[model samples]
Target: MNVSIIVPVYNEAKTVERVLMELVAVASNDWEIIVVDDGSTDGTRSILQTVCQEIGVAVVFRDHNGGKTAAVKDGLELACGRWVIFQDADLEYDPRDIHRLLAHAETGHRVVYGKRRGSWHRPNRWVFALGVLGVDLSILLLFGRFVRDHATCYKLIPRSVLTSLQLRSVGFEGCVEITAKLMRSGIPISQIPIGYTPRAMSDGKKLTPAYGFRALGAALRWRNWRPCPSPAEHTGSSSTLPAKRANSALN
Candidate 1:
């Protein structure tokens, strides 16, 4: 199957090259990399141009920084792959997980998420856990399914399913919107445990308490948002996405 790896970048010039190199080394020829430069004012754009020329990856430099959802949507519009992987430009997440994700995808899974599972024993950990809990509760009250980590970054979806999703959030809420939409749409998704290394704010980690609240608010508003069936459904492909209107429709 053709795989389109979508990397949404913003001020990640420091690590984007390494991520691209890993993709080139591990992915097959039919796999295409689409790097969406979300209006990086740093050297990120220059580095992306070089990578595009050298590695034959498609680079999209948006007119302005539209956030992660827009970048992914832009790539989806241009993707010709049978499946799509939403990857982070930062090397925080491992590229090797792609192989694991494909393992599930190849076995007839329509949606696969790399779920993060680890104990948070520190005081700050409780605070983060509380935040995650609050969001999960909100999602459950509104929709019905419980999402362990509604904000994880590693999600691999079929191209047809992804393309049919109409996303509007501009911040961390993108994660909530996508997950809720997928689950509500009734698409069967499998979760594979993955490692997550928390980064400090100084290390270019952008999620903040404010973004968290915004995400929760977005999830509440989109609680009724359902995903529409993809064009592939009529063709009897298991890869076809199910219809959902809210994140709580995960079951």
Candidate 2:
């Protein structure tokens, strides 16, 4: 397989099907879709079952709510592609941007990020600006590089490099953890501008100021950590079971 699209979903019933359809439309046959439902209770699970089955995508249903990091880790464990893209199921980020990110990968870039363009709907612009500044400053202090969107959900990482990291975050902090590890390992990260449509808290947007603080803490905690040795190349076969059978395996 060429690419493994790992979508970590929570209560995204409103947008999950549309996001999956967009992914399916943009991705080629060699690409595999792995949707990890993090114990969604808003009928998102039922929607995923139908959509994933219709598209022949692999869906892993968690018994209880684990955070985004845990859902991503589960999908990574089952990925059989050489590269993996973390795509959010909330539809904030566009799936078409994957093509733009892949353009850099084709030129030997192992890590690529989709930088958000245009203004976002923020409750307080100053607070959002400060949060972005905090994350960028934290990354600069830890890795000596400034990453504009440290908490972006559209990071495309090589499966080899991704599996090598000692990832331990269980929430939004995973973004910082991954960035710190990649930068410390001397991986060149490229970025491209992408479209973004931010959702308000009332629209099921989960990020908060508390999550930003946690991300900053995670960056500090992992600054001095060394990268683990890369594991032997994964040779596992991809699962072809229907969504129902896949959920059964999760149990």
Candidate 3:
């Protein structure tokens, strides 16, 4: 497969169905879309029945509400794509950009993040802007590199590179985990500007000022850490993706 798209959902019942439909429309036969339900208290699980009927789509219902990181880890084990990307259950991100990310990967860019054009909305924009700025600036100071937008939800990573990142974090902090580890690994991140329709807090937007602080903490804690060697790295087996393996060489 070319890319595996993992959709991590909590209680996003309103938008989850539409998101899955958009993904199914955008995905080619070679792509696999894995929808992970993080023990939704809402009727999201029922909505995912639509996903089961769609081809190239699969759903995994977690036992409990384990945040984005844990849900992704669960889906990653089943990924067979050369590259992997995360799609939030909300409507903030565009699904058509999946092809844009894949084109970048075809050009051999191992790590790519979709650059948001800008934030739009009222007081909600202020909240989001401040939190993103705080987390981004903190990571830049700690890692000596400006990542453009570490808080962008449209990060595209090679499956091999992702496996070697030793990613660990829950909720929004997972973004910080990926950014810090990649900076420490000396990987260059290429950003492509895209559109975003920012949502308000009342619209079920989960990120908050506390998430920003936790993200900064995650970045500080993970900085300078190296990825532990997987069995394939030691044995030189070079197994398929979702299998234990070392990182792929970047362009």
Candidate 4:
């Protein structure tokens, strides 16, 4: 498969089916949709099973609720695609933007983030602004690069790049963990402006102030981190195929 689109779903029963249908509509044979139902209790799993089966996508069910990080890690283990992209079950982000991210991939960008245009539509604008400022400042202090949307769900990463990182955040902080590790690994991340439709707190917007603090802590912890050497780095083996392909595309 050329693309592995990983969708980590939680208690999003009302929207999961629609999200799957949209993904199926946009995906071709070269794209594989991997849906991880993260122990959803709101009948999301049943909807996923029917929709995934009908659409011929792979679905994994966890016994209990794990964070998005755990679901994403499990999906990565099952991914066979050369490139990996993350999609949320919530309808805040549009599946159509995948094509735009893939276009940059065609030009050999290993890491691409769909930057949300303007502020989030949440009630408290100052809270959202503060969160963004904290994340961007943390990234700048760590990598000397200011990323507008470090917590964006639409991060397109090469399979090789994913394999190189040792991710440990089990909560929403996983976004910071991935971004920090990728920046530390000497990878340049490209950002493309994308649409966003923020959901209200009553509409299952799960991110909390505590999650923001945790993400900031993760960023601080990984500031001076370095990746362990891969077998390809040590022995120059074929395990480097993805990286080689990415580099060739850049040239």
Candidate 5:
């Protein structure tokens, strides 16, 4: 397989199916979509069951809600792509931008982050904006690399590079942990602009200033870590279906 998209969902019944449909429209037959239901108590699990069965996207139903990072790690185990990217169930991010980030990976960049477009709709997001700026500055202060959005959900990484990392974060700090580890290992993120549509707390937006603080702490913790096993080429995997055999929804 070429690209593997891992979608970690939790209580996103309203938007999960629509996001999957968007992914189907953009992803090629050779790409794999692995949806991990982070033990959602809502109707999301049922919807994913029906949607994945119909469209043939791989789905993993966790027995309990183990947070987003847990679901992400579970999806990674079954991923079989040369390159892997993440898609949030929330429509804040545009699925059509997947290939734009993939374009950088195609040209041999292993790590690509999707920079969200400015919010013209919400002018009062200074607090949210400040939290993100704190994350970017923390990385810059420690690694001498200015990463605009460490909390962005749209990082495209090679499966080989990802699996090689000693990923240990189990919550909202996942993105920050990955970025810090990569930078410590001498890898830098390549940024690509992508569309974004902000959602409110009433609309199930989960990020908070507390999460940002936790992520900043994570970024500080991994500054000096070294990788024993550097990134190597991944051979292949049996988890992915053949391109010719992929269902019409994915083709």
Candidate 6:
């Protein structure tokens, strides 16, 4: 099946090129790579444009920064493929795992999250772990889904499943919201073990402990608050969208 990889980036000038090169090297099947620039103030946008032009990849440049969630949502809407997967601009996650994800795409699983297995000595590891634990328990209690990893960006989702998702959060909370919504909708999900290289805060990694708390809270609230259809609902019926609601703090 054709694959559509949506990579939402912000100020990733240092690692974007290598990530793109890895994708080109490992991804042999028919695929479309969509790089969404989330209002990057640095030369990230220019670099993305140049790389996409050279690699013949698709590009979606947003004028204003809407955070990772908004950028990813936009890219998914424009994607035309049987399978869609999310990739981070940083090379933390390996591109070679794409094939492992696709191998399970035909098994009726709607979403596949790359579960990172590593020792906890990294910075903010405790807070992120606790937040993930809280969020996971909340999901089980509210949605009856037990996901090993709740906020993983390396998620492979079928186009049909992506269409059914109704998301609006523009931050890390987006990942929690999507997980909760998909599980609530009775979509099958799987967690696969993958390699992860944690980056330090000084390395331009923006997901901080504050964002982790915000994400955990969002997961809990999203379990109860039903999301409305986004404006992109009319684009296709395969998406099976919900109604839109203003960006709620809890959502």
Better of 1 and 5 by TM-score: 5
Residue-level lDDT tens digits of model 5 in 1-251 = 88889999999999999999999999887789988888789899888878987887888777898878888998888788888888899998988888889887778776999988768557446777788888889889988888888888999988888888868887888988888888877877899888889887778877876877797788878888788776568745646342222332232
TM-score of 4: 0.89
Model 2 ranges off by over 4 Å: 231-251
- Give the CA lDDT, 0 to 100, for residue 81 in model 1: 74
| Clashes per candidate (backbone, < 3 Å) | 12, 0, 0, 0, 0, 7
TM-score of each: 0.85, 0.92, 0.88, 0.89, 0.92, 0.85
Off by over 4 Å in 6: 225-251
Between the candidate structures 2 and 3, which one is better when assessed by TM-score?
A: 2
Q: Which candidate is the best by lDDT?
A: 2
* Each prediction's whole-model lDDT (CA): 0.75, 0.84, 0.77, 0.80, 0.83, 0.75
**Shift of residue 18 alpha carbon in model 1, Å:** 1.1
lDDT of each residue in 67-170, candidate 2, tens digit only:
99999999888887877889988888889888888888789777898888856556664565579778889789878988888888889888888988968988
| TM-score-best of 5 and 6 | 5
Give the per-residue lDDT of model 4 (tens digit) for 53-118.
666677888878889999899888777777889999889899999999999867977689999875
* Superposed Cα deviation of residue 125, candidate 4 (Å): 4.5
Query: What is residue 161's positional error in candidate 2, in angstroms?
Result: 0.5
Relative to the unseen true structure, what is the C-alpha lDDT of residue 99 in candidate 6, on a scale of 0 to 100?
A: 86
For residues 1-251, could you state the per-residue lDDT of candidate 3 as single tens digits? 77788888999999998888888888887777777788988888777755444443567777699888888988887777777899998999999997897797569676899988755656768777877887888888888888777888898987777788866776778898998888777778888887787888899887777887788789879977876653332212222443222111100
For candidate 4, the lDDT comes to 0.80
Looking at model 1, which ten-residue stretch has the lowest summed lDDT?
242-251
Residues 1-251, candidate 1: write the lDDT tens digits. 37878888999888899989988898886677778888999899888777766776677777689888888887776676777888887776777888898898778887888887665553355666678778878887877877677777878887777767777877668888888888778877688887766665677766766766887788877878866656763212222111111111211
After the best TM-score superposition of candidate 5, give how far the Cα of residue 26 lies from its true spot, in angstroms. 0.8
Q: Which is the better candidate, 4 or 5, if ranked by lDDT? A: 5
